[model samples]
Target chain A: MIIQKPGIAGTLESSDAQVTVEPGDGKIEFELESAVINQYGLQIRKITYDTLKRLGIDNVKIKIVDKGALDCTLKARIEGAVYRSCNQYNDLPWGGAIQ
Target chain B: MKNPNMKRLRRTMMFLNAQKPGLIKDPYIYKPDSIMLDLEDAVAENQKDAARFSLYHALKEIDYHGVERVIRINGLDTPYWQEDIRCAVAGGCDAIRIPKTESALDIHLVEEKVLAAEKEFGRPEGSTLLMAAIESARGVMKALDICDASERLFGIALSGGDYTKDLQTHITGTGIELMGARQNLIIAARAAGKQCFDKVYTNLNDTEGFRKDVETIHLMGFDGKSIINPRQIRIVHEIFTPSQKDIAFSEKVVKEIDSKKAQGIGVFTVDGKMIDIAFYDGAKRTIELAKASGVYKGEL
Candidate 1:
């Protein structure tokens, strides 16, 4: 899926990436193939896990394709993807499927 | 080397405590994610010794829960810097904010001294992290090298006041003049795989302008922005947080993607737009922010 926001907050030039997240029965998968990851290693994974756990997602698979994305861009992209997949945008203060 | 379960939610920290007695009490009580008790810029020439003593005692006595304690020592160029480093290390600071770093050599200099002091004081050798304050044009130019200088380095901050003066540029609220510098710093920090922060916005009374500036900086990709006043902390935090509408939309996207994948669908539509693996990635990030900001309380 291609998600693009021409004007977003923060420095958007150097730090941009593509991530892939898939959820299943009590298991979510994530994969990342980011230039940022190739350059900086798996630092963004650390941030992603932290964010997912906090959201109370215990079983997940995530894939990312990074191109030197910043913290905000990483967060925004992951968030947009999760919301789109879960179909929980209409509800307030969402409680995830597993919980 | 990476812990998958670490949250990116760092508290907004403000630097405080100088040679002056009443300065700490000037800002609101119990705010900011952390407070850097500075014996550096805010302290006067004669009061360095006293400030160190006060800082040590304060660390020993103060109960700053949820508030990380950091110390900014005098720059390495000065005679007082060594002693300042020793005192802060001995005083049990969370990190040492080193100033005017031009290269990795500067970080190593302070790291060597800090290590020696840690050994002498029976403190753990790697207990303290180093924060590099990039001031001056040279420092900005070599930020990436300085960031990767040591594993002890945790974060890098833009010292706007000194940087501007050193570059012979005037400071402005719009910060258009500092955009290149800011972008450079962020790029360097990211390249080095470290957290980068924006410089302090000096206009104390211009709360609206400050908020706008924070949003701009936040959008530019900074983890956090420095604050001279307690008032600015909340404003920065608010701007950094993801919105309600954003959270809901992200949730919908994730659900739809999952349902489609279950039916062996590789691609689908959301709101009349094509959806695929890449779209799922952005949706997950929205959920992550919602979780970080306490908007989502679900299973990971």
Candidate 2:
């Protein structure tokens, strides 16, 4: 689904990641900041890219401020932001891709 | 993995705000019999849409070990409950807790949606369970009808926070304001063959007060309490543990019943307490609880 506008999910809490998705050009603009960036930064970026791709969106500016969140939390926050951008609140495919 | 049993031990169903990812991730570590992923009171109104996203994902990602996963959705009167069910059932939540349930129709409405979601999600039909929160005097008065409303219902819980507001009264030290409502709810749940839970004790500072309420409700035949904090879990479990005397007496009842069954005798006196087949289940359940609580010393 196409993202309608700027969408965000998660919180600036420990073990969570605050993700924001906004309109972008034909390129995927990704910015990430986390305490574990040096150790898990590449993994986090891959997960974000995979989650965004699974939601069928790529051309968006993604900002991730992670706080030691697990891969599952990252994926969930990313998907949530994607759906919020598209303004789809109902009928969430919970067991969907990036699970 | 136990298929969510209707008669599972639900001594404490702690309410965790679903929007809080940190709290929801590992609440099972405390070993509450159930964890209620709250989507109503704990969540802010503007963030209801956001909370569902987290709730659905947490329910999918977390294993939750053996602790029962319950989702306390918004009331049927609200616009959020149907969508809440869609997320909960798809995530395979063990039970859906309906808030401010006033009548049988409320449960029927949720049941209809739950069935549809189960079908749409390819879950086993009738796998999801439903519970109602009686939040007003009208709901208390209509308790039996509500309890008998749905076959998928495992029980009903009294939400004292809202009920007190509807009555224009407040909680008292001795629980006089809540005693009648609690009695009626337990009776209705028992009559309908469903488990009943006590309302949450809001005061965490008063350990003595909480203890009194727990003991009182246990005697009043409540299966559990909707708690907010983890500190209450140990206290509730300790209170629910079968004492040594209780275990011995229950063991004697079971042994005597087993031996007397050959003689076709259904009634007997165990330690001068009249016991029969009706008491058999209670006796066995005591032994099971004793074993589970690690207080049982007998070989049998």
Candidate 3:
């Protein structure tokens, strides 16, 4: 639930987003850079916030470099980076926290 | 929708890295019989968890048209396989491939976990099917047990890369070193009434060599092949598809066999070839393959 350390996941592939997360100062700090920022930027931001909320993290600095990744892919990248940041590898809550 | 049939037509099972959204998002466009969403070997060690996240999400959201979605989980020897099973089962994968399977006990172990995960995820108790990859000498020697390990197991596949290493050899392209394992695996799979699949031919440049390898496996009675690329899918399907002549002959043989059996005759000849009850299944299989390949016009 806590972003104890910095964690990063994903790549700058054609249909992927590289997500980076670090501990933030008592509030969610989100930044996004995507190819389709004119159209899907708000949707991408909402997905990141919702995914972070699901994982019980509201106080983290999350940066996303999106290359036109879909909603599912964005969520996966966020979950991956969040989990890695917390060093919680075993007993992953697949459909629970990660969903 | 996820394919429900356990023994459907699977001429090609294309491997895709679960970590790459670009790769897994729309692989069904290539029209492989199945897509092997790999969480093992294809993913780097540090990226295992990341890959699982990608895999779970893809399985949940992606529309694979009619292509079977099979997840290749991490091996049993690692701590990753359990979560891999849980993720794949929760994501509603059509099947889970156990890497480096060596014994019946290994299959049983995975089956137990799969059942538990299925219950936890509220999936049908027996909906999650399984397949094992024989990647070692021990696995090949114990192929029958692996096939008979669980009713959930629909088939077995040869992992040539690792199996060859265990055999103290490398890929010779001629498949001479793999002849024994391939023969043994298909025999075991047939004996257990399960499908058998050949390994991926890694050489992308040698199209001719790939064709020959596919032909050999097709002649050896393999139900399908593990393909690495979309280009290879056509080759496998083409080789596996029964020719029009073969389909026609098979239909005639089936009809003739039925008439002969009705007349209380067990032996006869069709088109100058000796026919008997033993040849009936092979003939029927050809017709079925033709139907699956969309080449059959005869009704028998």
Candidate 4:
């Protein structure tokens, strides 16, 4: 799905990641800010990219302010932000595209 | 299509915000009989959509270790309840709880949407059970209708916060304000053969008051109570579980009842008490509660 506008999901609370998705160029632009950056940075990046790919979002500026969120939480925040950006809330593909 | 879990033990149904990753990630550790993933009042107005995403993933990926997952959907008045149903059904939640249910029609509307979502998502036609939260005077008066609304409805719960507001009173912490509603709801649910749950006791600091409230509800014949904190779970379980002497007496009652029935006796005294068929189910229930609470190791 296309990122029609900027969308954000999640919180600065501990064990949550604030995900932001915005329209981008022809390629994916990724940025991350997390306290556990040195330890689990690569895994977090992989989860973000993998989730974006699954949602058919190839070109978007995705940023996550991670507070030690798990893989499932990161995916949820990404899905929430991506869906919100497209102004789509109903009839969401829960296990389909969002998985 | 009958729900086997209709009569399961639910001494405590803990509420957890669906939007909070930290809260929802691992609540099964506390081991409440069921976890209510609140997509309703617990979530902010603008965050409802985001909460659903969090809920769907949690339902799909989190292994709750057999703790029942009941999602509290947005009320019927909201535009969000439909999508909330779809997301919860598709994510394979065990049940959907409709908040502020006033009549049978409300349950029918929710059941219709749940059926459609189940079919659309390829779940079994009646796989998803439902619960109704009676939050107003209208809902309390119509409790019997709501209880008998659908075959998928396993129970009804009291949401005391809004209920008190509708009654033109506030929670007095003395349980005086909620007497009528609680009595009426339990009677309606029992009359309809559905389980009834009491409202949450919010004063966490007043453990003594909480225990008294729980004990009162338990004695008043409520099957369970809604809990806000894990600290409340142990207390509810402690009060709800049958004592060792009670369990032993129940076991003897069951055995005596069986033996007496085979010998063509209708009523008999057990331990100098006037025991009859009327006491049989109650005795059996005590034994069952013991077993469920992990305090019994008896064969019968």
lDDT of model number 1: 0.69
Top of the candidates by lDDT = 4
TM-score attained by model 3:
0.96
Sorting all predicted structures by lDDT, with the top scorer first, yields 4, 3, 2, 1
Stretches off by above 4 angstroms in model 3 are B1-4
CAPRI level of candidate 3: high
Provide the lowest-lDDT 10-residue window in model 1 chain B: B2-11
In model 1, what lDDT does residue B13 have? 61
TM-score of 1: 0.68
Across B1-300, the per-residue lDDT of candidate 3 in tens digits comes to 333576789999999999999899999999999999999999999999999999999999989998999999999889899999999999999999999999999999999999999999999888999999999999999999999988889999999999999999999999999999999999999999999999999989999999999999999999999999999988899999998888878888899999999999999999999999998998988988888878887766
**Of the candidates shown, which would achieve the greatest TM-score relative to the real structure?**
4
Cα deviation at B261, candidate 2, in Å, is 4.8
**Residue pairs with clashing backbones, model 3:** none
Compare candidates 1 and 3 on lDDT and give the better one: 3
Better of 2 and 3 by lDDT: 3
Residue-level lDDT tens digits of model 1 in B1-300: 432222245436687854433444323364676677788888776546545544554554455664666788888888778777766777677788898889999999999998987886667778877889998899989989998998888778898988989888878777977888899999998888787888888879888888888888888888787776777777877877778776766777789888888899988777777878788877797687668667686564
User: Order of all candidates by TM-score, from best down to worst?
Assistant: 4, 3, 2, 1
Off by over 4 Å in 4: none
Kindly provide the TM-score of model 4 when superposed on the true structure, using C-alpha atoms: 0.98
**What C-alpha lDDT, on a 0 to 100 scale, does residue B98 get in candidate 4?**
97
lDDT of 4 by residue, B154-243 (tens): 999999999999999999999999999999999999999999999998889999999999999999999999999999999999899999
lDDT for B243 (candidate 2): 86
